[model samples]
Target: MLTQDIRQSAPVTPTQAGTVATLMIEEETTISDAPLFVPEDIGAGLLLLGLLLSPKPPKER
Candidate 1:
């Protein structure tokens, strides 16, 4: 899929903007088999971890 197509289809958040832009540019310019860890993955993972670890509010009586 084209970078523009991907960008249009995916929702871009403020935190993910940089990562998404970099990925889009790379996708548009190159075809490589390099093994890399994108910042977005780490950000998502951390967000998930934070959500999982946060305490839930007590139920109303």
Candidate 2:
């Protein structure tokens, strides 16, 4: 478990909260002509599925 002193670092003030909120709103309003998603090869998915289906090794003592 973590100690108490490590958890008492600086907390955000109201002023900082307002600034962060403003920045977030500004970012949301901006739009880009860039593509949102890129298409991947079918083989890539197969490779990942193969890895997930493979059996794991026995746990070490």
Candidate 3:
């Protein structure tokens, strides 16, 4: 198989001491690009839904 040949050609070796690998990721976003609904928005929506769906007390005669 191709994988078997690759493995045989380049054998795996343990990392050497004092060796460090650094991975840096950079993301760029503009102010115009914003999420439609954030956590606070979802929480507020749930709270409003609960208030609207809650039972109401009876009125006095």
Candidate 4:
């Protein structure tokens, strides 16, 4: 419901705690304070998460 409203809103803003995240994807988005996480950055972050979650070798006691 909220997402739908945001999607339909003329201007959208994403806030966390009290600060807004800046959006860099578009000038028309109007989410200037919204943090912009680029596709490449998100991909890299997901890759790092996968690596961290993968099985690890046994450590010596």
Could you say which candidate leads in lDDT?
2
| Model 3 TM-score, all chains together | 0.30
Comparison by lDDT, 1 against 2, better one = 2
- The parts of candidate 4 lying over 4 Å away from their true place are 1-38, 57-61
For residues 1-61, write the lDDT of model 3, one tens digit per residue.
Answer: 4555443455334452223221233345556865576678589889999999999988899
> What TM-score, computed on C-alpha atoms, does each candidate reach?
0.32, 0.29, 0.30, 0.27
- Model 1 residue 2 lDDT score: 55
Write candidate 4's Cα lDDT for 1-61 as tens digits.
3554334535544454224433433346454686777789689889999999999989999
Candidate 1: pairs in clash: none
- Order the candidates by TM-score, highest first: 1, 3, 2, 4
- Candidate 2 lDDT tens digits, 3-56: 666567588999999999998777555666887565565779988998999899
Evaluation by lDDT, superior candidate among 2 and 4? 2
lDDT of candidate 1 over 1-61, digit per residue (tens): 5555443567768879988778877755567788888888689889999999999989999
Model 1: weakest 10-residue lDDT segment is 1-10
Candidate 2 off by > 4 Å:
1-8, 27-61
- State residue 16's C-alpha deviation in candidate 2, in Å: 0.2
Clashes of 2: 0
- Candidate 4 global CA lDDT score: 0.64
